[model samples]
Target: MNYRIEWKQILKNKEKVQCSSDWISAESAIQLGEELERNGKVTDLYFYDEMGVSWNMKEMRKLLLEIEEEPHDITLYFDGGFQKETYQAGLGAVIFYHQGKKKYRIRANNLFNEMETNNEAEYAALYFALGILEELGVEYKTCEIKGDSQVVLKQLEGEWPCYEEVLNRWLDRIEEKINKMGIRPRYTVISRKDNKEADKLATQALEGKEIYAKTIIL
Candidate 1:
């Protein structure tokens, strides 16, 4: 959530103005508005998010408070693969978000040889994504976690029972991490075609290719 301040004309008497900042974490907006009012630069202040959504002082304050303890909408895609011959695993994720006026994507992948099964690899991939999101400070917003694997999605959503002790442990860890981050995970299942970018990145990891990226907005 990032914002910029702008002045505009609204109606005949109301001055149309916008403040630039991440409404996802709007604590600063209220303070900034009060400071502007104190300075006599503006009688009142209004905040608009990157989406041009306007919020009043009270509403903005409430959102900030909630966000301080909760997460907002963040999209995460996870994919992974495993090889039988060497017990090698590869994982990938693509995190996309828009806060304030900026849109960002964080694409990442990892290679590990210790994983025993595809399910573990998939969970590890999702974990890799969470690590990246944590680095980007996304724990402060809501998260939309997407994956191509139905097994992972179903288990994460508690739609299917995970009986494997190892996998169950992984599931618990994932949930714990999400909770610690204050993330509200909205899990969804997408077809492989829809998750091509992340799938390709995961395959690249299997091929021993290094990971690359554009940006990971915090």
Candidate 2:
């Protein structure tokens, strides 16, 4: 997670002024906050996360310790493929996260028989990934979401307007789930080549091969 340090600083002329630093990592914010406290000139020190939630030095330290045992530094990759011939859709999701000192990767895929379009499938794949995150107890954390579907990513980012009612419904469902899970998502569009892993998983699902695996990366 990232935070900005905000506090009141006492100037040499006995003037009190508010000061805030640029957004930085939680660890860095804590380190800097401690150093500022040692100077004895800084007061009301606090850190605010991207969600605009503020935390005091004591609260932040305790929260950091708790977060270390859960999932953090998360990156999710998702893709979906639809076959018009049979109205079948395959959804794939891959998640990478840090728990304590270890890094882990999870791969999962599913097949559905009633998808209307590939765009809908793409949205479903992202929703499926969110379910995985919830099962892993990920909450109140930033997640970097990557996918190759321009329509899905752009629409989610509000860069492109979604005119289809079906797609809008999917968008609503996805947003509702995200809010309920307290997930902060950063969406990125990547080339199909760069998303080969997720693409392959979707393809495997279409071939009737299912997979759900998690492994330690470091």
Candidate 3:
């Protein structure tokens, strides 16, 4: 997670002024907060996360410890494939996260029937990934979501306007789940070549092969 440090600093002429640092990692914020305390001129030190939630020094320290034992630092990739002839849609999701000191990756896929278009399938794939995050007990954390579908990712980021009623419904559902989970999502678009893992998984699902696996990585 990333946060900005905000505090009140006392100037030489007995003036008090507010100061803040750029968004930085939690560890770096803590280190800088401690150093600011040692200077004895900084007061009301606090950390503000991307969601605009504020945390005091004590609270921030405790939160870091608590989060270390849970699933945090998440990155998810998703893709969808649709077969027009069969009206089947295949969804795939790949998740990477850390729990304590171990790093883990999860790969999951599902197949659905009667999907209208590949765009709708793409939206469904992302929604499927959110379910995996929920099952992993990931909440109130920032997740970097990556995908190759420009329509899906851009619409989610509010960069593109979605006109299809069906797609709008999917958008609402995805946003609802994200808000309930307190997930701060950072969306990124990548090339199809870069999304091969999720693409392959989606392809497999379309071929009647389902997959679900979790493994540790170095």
Candidate 1, superposed: residue stretches over 4 Å from native: 1-72, 215-218
lDDT of 2 by residue, 1-218 (tens): 78999999999997999999999988999999999999999989999999999999999999889888999999999999999999998999999999998999999999988889999999989988899999998888999999999999999999999999989998999999899989999999999999999999999999999999999994
lDDT string, candidate 1, 1-218, tens digits: 54433333243466665444443345556776656656554533567765566766677777766654433457899999898788988899998876554567878898988888999999999988998888767754557888889999999999999999989988999999998887767789999999999999998999999786867466
lDDT of 1 at 215: 76
- Error (Å) of candidate 3 at residue 112 is 1.3
Comparing 2 with 3 on TM-score, the higher-scoring candidate is 2
Full-model lDDT for every candidate: 0.77, 0.94, 0.95
State which candidate has the highest lDDT.
Answer: 3
**Clashing residue pairs in candidate 3, if any?**
none
lDDT of 3 by residue, 1-218 (tens): 78999999999997999999999988899999999999999989999999999999999999888988999889999999999999899999999999998999999999988899999999999999999999989889999999999999999999999999999999999999999999999999999999999999999999999999999999
Ranking by lDDT: 3, 2, 1
What TM-score does each of the candidates earn?
Answer: 0.69, 0.95, 0.95
> Native-vs-model 2 lDDT?
0.94
Candidate with the larger lDDT of 1 and 2: 2
Displacement of residue 200 (Cα, Å) in model 2 is 0.8
Residue 37 lDDT, candidate 3, scale 0-100: 97
